[model samples]
Target: MDIPFIDLDAQEKVIGKKLEGAVETVLQHKKFINGPEVSVFEESLAKFANVNNAITCGSGTDALLLPLMAIGVGEGDAVFVPSFTFVATAEVVSLLKATPFFVDVDMKTFNIDPEILRNAIIASKKMGLKPKVIIPVDLFGQPACYDQINEIAEEFSLNVISDAAQSFGAKQGGKPVGGLAHITSTSFFPSKPLGCYGDGGAILTDDKPLAENLMSLRAHGSGKNKYDNVRIGLNSRLDTIQAAILIEKINILKNEIEKRNLVAKKYSEEIDKKIQKPIINNGNYSAWAQYTIIYENRDQLSEYLKDKGIPTVIYYPKPLHLQSAYTVFPRYPKNLKVSEFLSSKVLSLPMHPYLSSAQQNFIISSINKYTKEK
Candidate 1:
């Protein structure tokens, strides 16, 4: 038998019936776009995140894009983002013709360094670019240091849009990820902690006016009716089927997050002490989207695990700053040494709520065996 990487099959076995019923209900209604379920899911999501409004969208990228469009980010505007995160964090800025000024991440948290962000903002202004927004990413299910980021944003008069695609169910300082920043965006791409069946995403915010603008921007910027186009917008509504599926998934998200934490604890406690484990800051609870560790010979370890029917993946083999497409962008401190170094050393092991102890034990033992020999 093969060890499953995410074991979505196991998750399906637990909630398959509920998921099927949700889909069936959507099919019966036959209202696929902007259906009743969409609003219901949005309300549930708002409540879960303890926010005032939640707006559903087409994908994670759209979730970020809609907010940028709402705030009118354009050319000469500089959006600060960590180079260690997924491209979508910076991609949305470039799509709007805004400058994506990359910043270095903390070696410990793998998140944007608040100090680096402040420096980047000053650097942008020095170069004659307007510092517009600060996009802080919650890398590997852990939330970024939002308190510091928010304070800096206030000092600089910038918006904070959290790229929380990997951290929907996570929390920091007893507050959920979606409510930690001025605006939060999360993905439901079937692999996140609280994922739906297909491509779906949502934006969360406490600012009611901003939320209303986002709602309009997601659906052709309509006002009063579909024919009334109030502003330039994109067709980015979530499917009714996917909304129904997410409703069921969200209902049990707390339980699933607890299970994922347990799985993470086992890996942290049992993995070899010599291998550098992930650092989860105090008062921050991770969704454990991926259980990543730093090993000098990451490629060798990954190949050895593959030979043993165990799976290992590198979340990012290359940081965005080093990529050809992003080379032209300016970076703070110029070097981005940490992000560049992590690219070669970091490796992600299988992580999900359905991961079992026996399977976890096998993975840990395999890793220990390989490290011992090395």
Candidate 2:
């Protein structure tokens, strides 16, 4: 049998019955839009993340967009983001007509470097742009250096919006991802650690006023009634069926995260030593969204693994700043050397909660064999 990169089938075997029941319940209710399940899931999600509010949205992009809208980000405002993250991080800023000022990432964590972010904020101010928000991405399921990022935000009076698309089940300083930033956004894309069946995302926060605004913003900016348009907003509502599906999945997420960590631990211990392993900082626990490694011969290993029926993927082969559409945007330090270097070296191996021991051993040995032969 072919080794699947993420065995959703295996996950189904573990929770298929519950998932069916959840879906059936939604079907029985027939309230697909903004149904009862949506609110229940939102409450559960907020509790899981230890936040006061969790507002469900249409997609991960909307999760980021809703917060920006609530905060009134607009033209001439500069939102500092890591150059290495998915485009959605900066794309939301641009959609609001704000400038996406790119910053370099930390060599170890692959997250926005605090020093670089501070410098970027200063430089943006000098360039006559208003540095209003800092959107730090928690790359590869691990939380970024929030302590430093928060300090820098304080110094500059910037709002910190954590793009935690991959780090939802992770923790920093014992606090969950949702509570780590002023406003945290996460994705439930099918591939994420705690994904639902389809595109789903949520924004988490403790500020009730901000939460109220986000709730309004996710809808058509309604006030008192759906027709009472208070502010400009998008029609981004989480489907009831998706919410029901996520409720079942979220119940098992903690256990699944634990299993994922065990798999990551075994891989780290047995994989080739010459290839650099993911560096997770102390006081942080990752969701293990993808167990990525850094090696000079990343493409070669990926090709070799494919030939061996072992699938490997590069999270990103190009940095956002270097992308054609993003080339015109401003970048701190001019070069973004680390983001560029990581783009060339990083390769993600198969990662999921249901990876069997035998399957994992095969992947490790295959990598070692290639390392030895090359």
Candidate 3:
């Protein structure tokens, strides 16, 4: 049997009843727009993340864009973000006509390097630009070093927008991931640990006024009415149907997270030393969004696994800097050696909460056989 990566069918089975009921409710109400389901999901998410407010949006990218608009991150401002992360993290900065100063990442956590960020800020100041915000991504279900990053932000008086797109249900020292930064953005990309049936995302913050601004921004900048257009904004509101689906999934989030961890632990323990395993921060608990590994000969391993009927995915075969769309920007470390290095070698295995033990064993055996070849 083919050992497919990320078994979504298993989860669908687990939450079938709740999901079915939610779909039925949406059908009955025919509230395809912002309805009661949206508000209910937002409330549950805010409480779960321990944030004062949560604003639902159409997608993860919009979730980032909405907060940037609310905080006035526009032209003449620079947002520091890791070059090793997804384009969305830096795309929001560019979308506002603001520049993004790409920083280096910590080797262990694959998050932004705090020291490098500090240096980048100083360098930007020397170049006569204002570093207004820091968009540290919680890459691959693990959070960036918010404690250190936040300290630097405080000293520099910059804002922190945690891109917890892959890390909504994660934790650090008993503190949840989303609340660690000033404002946080997360994705419900169907495959994410806490996902909706369709494209969905949310922005969380303790600042009430900012929340209000984002809510308005998501609805074409409407104030008290849909066509009001109080300010320039995008149509980024979450669908009531998707919100309803997410509400039911939220009920089993903790259980799903526990299972995800078990899968992660098993991968870490079972994989050979030749295949570099993922690292976890001592105070942090990853949602285990992707059980990625590194290898000297990625192509060979990929081919070997393909022959064994095991699938693999490259989380990022190329860093944002090397991508055609972002290659023009000036990146930190001048050359982005780590970012370039990781892109060619990092490979993600099947990662989800529901991978059965038998499937996992088959995957591990194939990987071990491939790596041990003479």
Query: What TM-scores do the predictions have?
Result: 0.99, 0.99, 0.98
Tens-digit lDDT track for model 3 on 45-125?
998999899999999998898888988888778899898888899888998998888888877788899999999999888
Query: Which portions of model 1 show Cα errors greater than 4 Å?
Result: none
User: Which lDDT tens digits does candidate 1 get at residues 1-374?
Assistant: 37888888998898899999989988898998888999999999999999999999999999999999999999999999999988889999999999999999999999999998899999999999999999999998999999999999999999999999999999998999899998999999998888888899999999999999998899899888899999999999899999999998898899999999999899999999888999999999998888899989999999999999898888788888888988998899799998988888999998988888888889999999999998
The local lDDT score (0 to 100) that residue 270 gets in candidate 3 is: 91
Could you give the C-alpha RMSD of every candidate to the true structure, in order shown?
0.8, 0.7, 1.1
Report the CA-based lDDT of candidate 1 relative to the real structure. 0.92
- Which clashing pairs does model 3 show? none
Could you say which candidate leads in lDDT? 2
What is candidate 2's lDDT per residue for 1-374, written digit by digit as tens? 38899989998998899999999998998999999999999999999999999999999999999999888999999999999989999999999999999999999989999988888999998999999999999999999999999999998898999999999999988899999999999999999988989999999999999999999988899999999999999999889999999999999999999999999999999998999999999999999999999999999999989998999989889999999989988999899999999999999999999899989898999999999998
Worst 10 residues of 2 by lDDT: 1-10
Q: By TM-score, how accurate is candidate 1?
A: 0.99
Backbone clash pairs for candidate 2 read none
Q: Least accurate stretch of 10 residues (summed lDDT) in model 3?
A: 324-333
